[model samples]
Target: MDRHDQVLEVWREFIATGKISNEKILSPAIMNSWKRSRECGVDPYQKKVPVILKEHKLKNLLERNKDLIEICRPFIDNLYSFFRGTGFVAALADVDGYVIDVTGDKEVLEMTSRGSFVTGALWSEDVAGTNMIPIVLRENKPCQLRSTEHYCWSQHRMSGVGAPISNPAGQMLGVLVIFGPYEKANPHTLGMVVAATHAINNYFHVRRMLTESQISNKFQKTVIESIPEALIAVSNEGYIALANENARKRLSLPENITGKQIRDVIEPGNGNFLSIISSKNNIMDMEVQIIQDRKPKHYLLTCNPILDAEDNPTGKIIILIEIVRARTLVNRMIGAQAKFSFKDVAGNHPRALETISLAKRAARTLSNVLLLGESGTGKNIFAQAIHNESNRAKGPFVSINCAAIPRELIASELFGYSEGAFTGSKRGGNQGKFELSDGGTLCLDEIGEMPLDLQTTLLSVIEDKSIVRIGGREVVPVDVRIIATTNKNLKEEVKKGNFREDLYYRLNVFTIEMVPLREMKSDIALLARYFADKMSARFGDELIRIDDDVISILTNHSWPGNVRELQNVIERSISVSLTNVIAVDDLPPEIRKKPAAIERDVSLKAMERQLLLELMQSKLSKTEIARKLNVTRCTLYRKLKVYGIPYQ
Candidate 1:
């Protein structure tokens, strides 16, 4: 028979009835299926595809398994204990129906273990016969068999409850089977079993997704369970229900974690969000990055409501992902944490260093800070880093650029109006930046660009931290530290009567002026290396360094637009340069000078000596040059070198 006849025979073997040819046929590289059969490979079809997103960086994923397992033994015990003393036996079976753990009365356990039905037993569809454990494992659905439904005739006297176990990818982990007398079984018991199964799935999946892994039964059995961030799954009533590996280890959670309240885990000193968490269930998400009393860490939390079939919220599921690194702004750059820190400020400029020092000191206090710099000097970077270091670092850091914002909507955007405050005010009477930064820092960039009337309203916020929405009735008290930045000289604007002097004074309690790239040429090389590294990671290119001419042009050229101009040039150079090294000829037009001419006289004699010398020598670092020429480092490093002169 041809390939088509063989495929039809194989599929027909399953139904043993009507012809149901597939609409298409093909095989794949890694995995193939009945749908496509052109090539052959392993089959990995599944019911659902898991969502992939960012995960919290683990502190020590290596040691977590060991420490976490001991922590989880108690919680694991509770799951088995649910069926304990109920005369029912609970057994965890792998996807192949190989029982890993069998718990209950010893006699009942022994009774079920007989007939090749215990650990290592394979009762999958292709195995001994139809079995509840393997059925649930195959289907990923909850199932129960009443009297006479079981395949084995001898097992008719007992009923079985089984639920499928799943990994983070919605793949099967195993099956949880509760085998007991049929008479004692109730819908609540089945419901509880289903709930427990779902709870386990949620806990492992959330942790796995956050940690970016395929959390398996192996992780459960092995992980010493050293999860760093304190984790809890609450039921909206502020009741603490479930704690994952880290939370269990850190908090020493017991088997009775399901019925406990939030207060049970936190002593008064530990948790600051206790009041807010208890007041209501829904919070979009909360993140707190702290540097004091501990190393820098970003702790993120999201709360989702769990609903029943009727769509009524019965509880809340919370997951936590934390990132810790003082100099890594990987998350902040992508707005994962919505704030900047020292990690986000990557520069080596003398003035930038000075500004960073001042910002750090000012962050220690609650005073406002004014940052002055060109547009691309990364004022937002400084503002966010300051906020991240400040006392309110544990709260949100909200930013608004006055220059980019529309004039008429500035009021609504900053002070958030009610739903009907204006023609298109958000229906919910949205919370403004003030409300968003209630307990944190609010960075107002280009403060000098704010309109006159808005400046008056902003001055009120500085006087008394409060905001009145455009169409709202009452004043909302806001607790926030303000950080303002302006690329334009605020003094010039104030002189021109464009900016309010009162607001300027309020914001300029402490000031940091960012020197443009051209003025601070010292940091050019380091910034080049940094940008090269960043771009390489982004573009997957090995653009390691620039050539001598490229570096010389970079140093000699006047960057009218400052650091921003250099970045644009670098981007263009990388895209255009085909050579391994960058040449002055390849640099943007402004960098290179016209080649010097010696009157174009038939200068073959001079040119001959130049060509011969160039072939024999290469430029060196100042120290190297000094060593070669027997001159002082000072002499070799002068402007003569900048002009590419061959001085020996």
Candidate 2:
């Protein structure tokens, strides 16, 4: 007989007599397993392997072995694909010899069901009586059992091969098994099973390393973003590797700048900036000038070499600080912050309160504001209040009076100056009102008095939100909110060619007309009391009370100097008054001499008529004049008819 028939005869003889007469007919491994099975009292006539895992226990087992099954599933499918329709079946089992997964030909699977060859069935040597799974688990190596070689009589018609799958540490995690009919058993099946286990082990290791790398990268990104200064990482070969948000914003860099050359992003200033990064030594407090937006910006740079385990350079860490930001910090410490908010503005007149409401609304936006009123109307107070009320309240509140600064120095004062810009320029340089007010508000007081030549530059700066210092080629960016105040009527100035029309329109985005004290005379008593209390505290005295006669005199006078004149009168009264109660006798002689009934109505009407006549003579259309006066066409027409002025 052939090898199969001879092995079958030997297996029956061993089972019947409990001994093998010719030991050479069967391998010593198979003989030994049969001897062990008998010693353990395994039933030679058993028909099926018992399903040891219950539903709940099987679920827990699957979950525990999920990674192993996942890694081995494709390999199992591939192995089955090569032997499909040949009566072959493929399955995976855990270290305990319980089948966890299975796949096979439909007909073969149906046939195997009679023997309980399914998932969750135990196949240990004593229970299953020497199947391939038990053999591989016991031997810890590739194993094949064919026909009668299986100790149990139930599996005499089956043949199978199995291999132990282990992790990189060489500990067996599970077993891969492939089996078919005894008649089709081939030695090559064992090789295929062994190869698949090796492949699964390698793939598992790769997946674990990738997961670790992703976690590490996330941690590094978090640390980089937390740093406030501009930070960049460059590879040893000079390619950009990483940059933080601050670096991207301060340098105006693109979101994805990695892999680009370092020189491409930062323009070299006084020295070669890339060379400093490439140097082997660490650097600190090195002043560097880098051109951005066509303007040179100064930075205090620091660099440190990043080395590998062997001390070889792998990359570098570079930190950059804007020098202007340091100067701004000092400026803020000295008194650049806004001290007044909307709560500080105290007025009770309807018109005055309405103006405050408008200023409060203006503060909520980034639009430029124009405060139009006479001098001493607390326009500066409203300016400061707006700055304090804005979202940029944390930044500086810088004010530059166009009328106060000399005409020749107005441009440099407004835009800033470069080092050695002119004969008397400061040694390093000076930041202009715009730069100093970065991330805050810049109050251009008396904007109408600004030079005509400089108005063009101002308009450009307002539009572009950038400026180049005097004699400087580089452009510096600023985030300043503009709040301009002026006593002159800008529309008349624009018509007379004194102010640029475009500049006027730009600054007039949100107009707040500060009411003259005479127009809001109802608030005079209230403002007088506020000023009295304020001045009294300044003089280190108790809150002063104003007399009824003093309030009456203050309310009747036409305050051409507006709220400022009222404040001065209250201060004078407080200083000279003998008692805490201010009296009419304590008032200034000029205000006291002024007549109460000044006939302001007739003069106001006359001025309105003159204004209408001039506007009518100008190039503006009726609609334009109506819009400029902030009135409807119907109202303008009625006013023109009342004055007997011509209108078509």
Which candidate number maximizes lDDT? 2
Error of 2 at 161 (Å): 94
Q: Estimate, for each residue in 211-302, the C-alpha lDDT of model 2 and write its tens digit.
A: 77998888789888988789999998878999999999878788888999777766445246666667887877565677777667778788
Instruction: Tell me how candidate 1 scores on lDDT.
Output: 0.62
Candidate 1 lDDT over residue span 1-648, tens digit each: 754344444444423432334424312210122222112211112111121112231222213333333333344467666767666776666554554555677777676656445544444443333346755765578876653344334444567777776766877767777767767766666666687677777777777776755455447534434444455767767787667776554344565676778676543444655554554556543543323234333345556777889998777766555423211232244352444578756667667787778879988987899998887877778788888787777777778888888998888879877657767654445657776677777889888889999999999987988887788776667787888998888888999999899888998899888777888777776676677667655655555468765676687776777777777777666544433345455566666553553223444334534543553266645566456544344433332333355556
Candidate 1 ranges with C-alpha deviation above 4 Å: 1-340, 343-350, 594-648
Worst 10 residues of 2 by lDDT: 593-602
Clashes of 2: 5
List TM-scores for all candidates, in order.
Answer: 0.45, 0.47
